[model samples]
Target: MILPAPIPDRVDVVIFGGGVAGLWTRWRLEHAGYSTLLLESSSLGHGQTIASQGILHRGTKYAFGKDVSQASMELLMAQEVWSRAIKGVDGPDLRRVTVLSPTTVMWTSESFLSRFTGAVAAGVLKSDVKKLEGDARPAAFKSAPKAVNVWEIDEKVVDSSTLVRELARVVRGPMASLAPDAHTHWDLPGMLSWTDAAGRSHATHASAAVLCAGVGNESLITSLAGTTSVPGAAASHVSQRRPLHMVMMRGAPCDLFGHCIRELSDKPRLTVTSARDADSFVWYLGGSLAEDGVSRDESTQIDAAKLAVHECLPWVDVSRASWATLRVDRAEGRTATGKRPDTPIVSHIAAAGHTLAVWPTKLALAPAAAGRVFDLLETAGIRPTGVIDAGEPALSPAPLPWNEGGVRWR
Candidate 1:
């Protein structure tokens, strides 16, 4: 844990979230010689980041439809940016972050539509995937029936918790944690006030204040928008939440990271990622299962997930597995049709001062979010001021979902 330090009264930027996007933006700002202070109401990545399946999507999954959509192309660019960063080029050096899988497998069921979608996706993403058959197949599919088709796609899975810690470590500034009951009051141009553990209130000022809190951004944006005098500032950007009922299974049959593709949908049927849970491993399930499962209660979702696992991977035995469910919201900038935004969005509130609302949309596009903030800062003529000596790190990374206690698995 980072020892407490006296919160600086001023800095270059005051970021309001400690998730991937917030922490990443902090790292970028500090590296560019700007002083930053990050404030989190809870442990880092508590809701969205840690719950993410950590798939660095390459837009291949988006090609299962009739044609590649704009979201697919945006993710393709994000994939390239992240891949380069992972290799210690172009962006932040993520070599120290743990990679759960270098590549992910995409498998098609015996259904004709599933096979057809898989074939079309292969053609569209030819350079990113390669077919595997017989002895070339990974052990996870060794027992697969002849009708099943599997291909390895170039996508990297990461330990989101580790990435959060790494980003915090490199930020080289103070990160403050607000008391659970503490409320933040924002002022023009970068002033933030909050109560501390001892009931002491502290306030800091910066050149810019960025709202990076995921769902929390909703209320914060509402508050800021309510006070802004700029025309259409309230409507300039809005936040939306797309809820997901993700399933988790402990004591999974095997370590597998892949997506099960089916017909009539552009999204993967089931996207599974493996992560260590103590001495054993757990499989975090997402994609269509999570999306469609949103309406399902806990028990119903678990039952549906069990059926999905059995149906998708008939070769694997999961009699001893226990299951649980996590309900999370995919927070992003609201689009015209309530669809996912194609890229990171940064909105300048300019409410009496430089206040901005930011949403990376996807975890892989965090760097792009930072880039957007940078462009805004540059365009506004905000230069790097002297760094604030925050003494020691002040915040800690949040626990992963599987590691968090009190989960009642069945």
Candidate 2:
């Protein structure tokens, strides 16, 4: 319902950032018949997305042997979207990943298993479930394991770099070109003010601007007028949850394809997860103030990755460090008891005439966020959801994850 703006040369919907969310947004918008223009300050996907261990969550996050909830339902749908997008645009070299290499997921405590199992028995797990089994050991964890009822599934791993490259090819399309006009720096560096090497800026005539800048959205705190509000995150919790992540060039022996595991921390409610890719293992520490920024030393974290994985591979080459990026996972609308909050979307920058901010990786939760943003644009009479939100988090904009350091699309 966006009222037609003053005559502009192009109504290109400018998305900032070139990460998964930005690329996904471009795909969604273009497919929906919108003339979209994407701008990446660096290249594409030199940031957090490439550092991923490639465990495309198919709603199996906390649902090891349990049922899929509303969140899981949306996540499954997102996975399908990811699956289709990857299959459609990905090249053979890019898609050449260790497909279906098995792994195990375990919970140390039986009590937690009881709750998880109880949820499954009660049909909570079957709602959006593709499959659910318990008390069975996959050969991977069966060789010698201390846990029970390890569940495994047929999921996919993304060579994120390849995925990004294919996505870039698809979205850039034959006609898409470097936006050759000097972009207006709308009080920001990358997204709002993107002007590719050709110098073209974003179209200001759009009904609303979508901020896919990731944690860098802080750059828009000025646009939002003041600081953003964090409901349940605090300094102590964030520090306690501060994680150290590393990637070992040492070549792990484990078959990590389509496998992800989380080890709950000794500290109550804290956890760090790991997923092994063909190249290395990706370590993620959570249950702290992921939103307020990490309290741990970034370099030390990398060292820890070396040491932990070094135990598994003594000859690992510590010299060639693969790509790494620092990020604080933000959550929204925490429960009163304060566990990891489910699916988040913050609407309106209070006074900004027409802008929306989001954590793009939370694609499972983005359908809701996008609906809200589009609703706002609808108030201004602009309609852009022609492709519709198929429960995917493809909102709007390109990310900074891709860079020249590695052709993320490669």
Best by lDDT: 1
Candidate lDDT values, in order? 0.82, 0.41
lDDT of 1 by residue, 1-410 (tens): 65787788888888888999998888778778888888888888877998999988887787766546776777888888888777888567787889999999999887787888788778877898999899877677889898888999988999998888777776578888777656667765657788876678899887888889998877676666676565655633677778999999999756889999888577888899998766767999998899999999999999999888877887788889999999899888878778778788887766637777888988988888888898888788778886666665677777778777877889
Q: Which regions of candidate 2 deviate over 4 angstroms?
A: 1-8, 63-70, 83-149, 173-204, 223-249, 257-341, 344-346, 361-379, 383-410
lDDT of 1: 0.82
Q: What is the lDDT of candidate 2?
A: 0.41
Tens digits of lDDT, candidate 2, 37-148: 4545544654455544455555555554323365566667666555544454522122333333322232222245443553443243344333324335432333333332
Clashes of 1: 0
- Give Cα distance to truth, residue 106, candidate 2, Å: 5.2
TM accuracy, model 2: 0.58
TM-scores for candidates 1 onward, in order:
0.94, 0.58
